[model samples]
Target: MTVTLSDEARQYIGAFEEETEATAVDCLVDDEFDRLVFVVKAGEMPKAIGEGGETVQHLEEEFGRDVELVEDAPTAEGFVANALSPAAVYNVTISEMGEEDETVAYAEVAHEDRGVAIGKEGRNIKAAKELAKRHFDIDDIQLT
Candidate 1:
């Protein structure tokens, strides 16, 4: 389905004259409730947000609505990877092994996050493994 913004939201976007390129504002209605989400080009996030998020804060307060501004990236995968914890997983490599063609993926997590990587009673790590297997088709996960 297509998403559109209300006329009131358009007024907010026009307020930022300093931002040359036009940014996109969307109003979403989910099963739970309605929310406003703004999508701006990757490099234009700072200008869209203004200093200390004052622009979005002012808009939210004035409109009496929740607004979330998200910076759009070229690829959805790149966006997901970028949004994931960079410090925790510095590098990830995948390889296929054995005659059975099993996939093995290794993730290099930060030393500080060793405990979290392993998890309390290994529950977190197990969950991560399940999610990785589901999303990336990696049969094995080796965290270093």
Candidate 2:
């Protein structure tokens, strides 16, 4: 699916690419969370983040909001796993269920890292769901 970007998001991507010298596939402007989430091309995360996270820190300071980076994946399962980072994801299964055949990603996360997967106030899961829908047309993400 083609992901559409708002003007503001485009501008953010431009700045991020320029500063980090990395390619960004998508940017999510989450005003509710007061942060910008950038999905960079696979294997470009280190370059995007820079040494000691200085690049990300600089971008956050320049934009005046928290910055997050999620590595893009070629498959929905990998993408879902990347979206729920900092948590050990054992597996990801994408399935279509129900009468309408809604697509869902069931992530098998480490039992001990459930809180991190969910994030504080559910922000992590929210972002994961939004990204999944935007990129893969998935209806929802459920952590198991």
Candidate 3:
């Protein structure tokens, strides 16, 4: 289905276009959750990121909304990750189930790569927990 944009989102898109000189075609708003999602016709994700994701960061600051830009193309890794969150995980090992019932998982990558697996300030792991709760009814998911 064609995505729709709110008036505020339209304004954000306009501002982004003006500032970054990038064309944005469609946007969607999750009104209940107050999230803004954007779709770009341009095929390249790096171009969308635009010099350290600066364009998106600026737009997000201006809009004061959670903005997500998704490309139309289907990617294999993304497809697998999206399809298997909560159930199937990558580069993580279940290390311990504690007496308190909290579980710990360690990333199987190098120490430097831990941040990539766990994400910034553990947000990625938190998101993984939410997905796990939804799909598997788990209460806790931990990442090292």
Candidate 4:
């Protein structure tokens, strides 16, 4: 999908790429969460994060807001899993439902990590849904 980005988001991506030397494919300026969420190239997560997370920390400080990263995946299942990081996702099943054919992702998350997957105020899942819809045309995500 060709994701449209705002100028602000574009600027953020440029800065992030310059600082980390990693490729960023998309960026979401999530004002509701008071943070910037970046989707970087699949294999560049470690570089974006830097050693001991110092790179991300510096970005957060420079942006004056929390920064979150989601590694882009070729498949919807893998993308969903990456979006809900810090949570152990065992599997993801994508299915089309109802007459409208709304696409949904059913994620099997570790019971112990459910809270983390959901995040405070459902922020994690919300981000996952937004990114999924943007990249994979997924309409919803349900934890199973």
* lDDT (10s digit) by residue, model 3, range 1-144: 233456876986777667666566655554544555554545544665579888778777877776656443243233223322323346544433658665433433445554654655654455444433333334554433
RMSD of 4: 0.6
Any runs in candidate 2 off by more than 4 Å, and if so which? Answer: none
Model 2 residue 16 CA deviation in Å = 0.2
C-alpha RMSD in Å of predicted model 3 compared with the true structure: 8.9
**lDDT (C-alpha) at residue 69 in model 1:** 53
Better of 3 and 4 by lDDT: 4
lDDT score of residue 32 within candidate 2: 95
TM-score, every prediction: 0.43, 0.99, 0.44, 0.98
Task: Report the lDDT tens digits of candidate 2 across residue range 5-53.
Answer: 9999999999999999999999999999999999999999999999999
Stretches of candidate 3 off by over 4 Å are 1-6, 74-144
As for TM-score, the candidate ahead, 1 or 3, is 3
- Candidate structures ordered by TM-score, highest first: 2, 4, 3, 1
Q: Write the per-residue lDDT of candidate 1 for residues 1-144, one digit (tens) a residue.
A: 223455765665565333434365332222132335455556877776778878777766765666555444454333222223323667666678999998766667779976766755654455444434434455776776
Candidate 4, residues 36-140: lDDT per residue as tens digits? 999999999999999999999999999999999999999999999999988999999999999999999999999999999999999999999999999999999
User: lDDT at 60 for candidate 1?
Assistant: 66
Instruction: Please report, as a residue range, the 10-residue window in candidate 3 with the lowest summed lDDT.
Output: 75-84
| Model 2 whole-model lDDT (C-alpha atoms) | 0.97
State each candidate's clash count. Answer: 0, 0, 0, 0
The 10-residue segment with the lowest total lDDT in model 2: 120-129
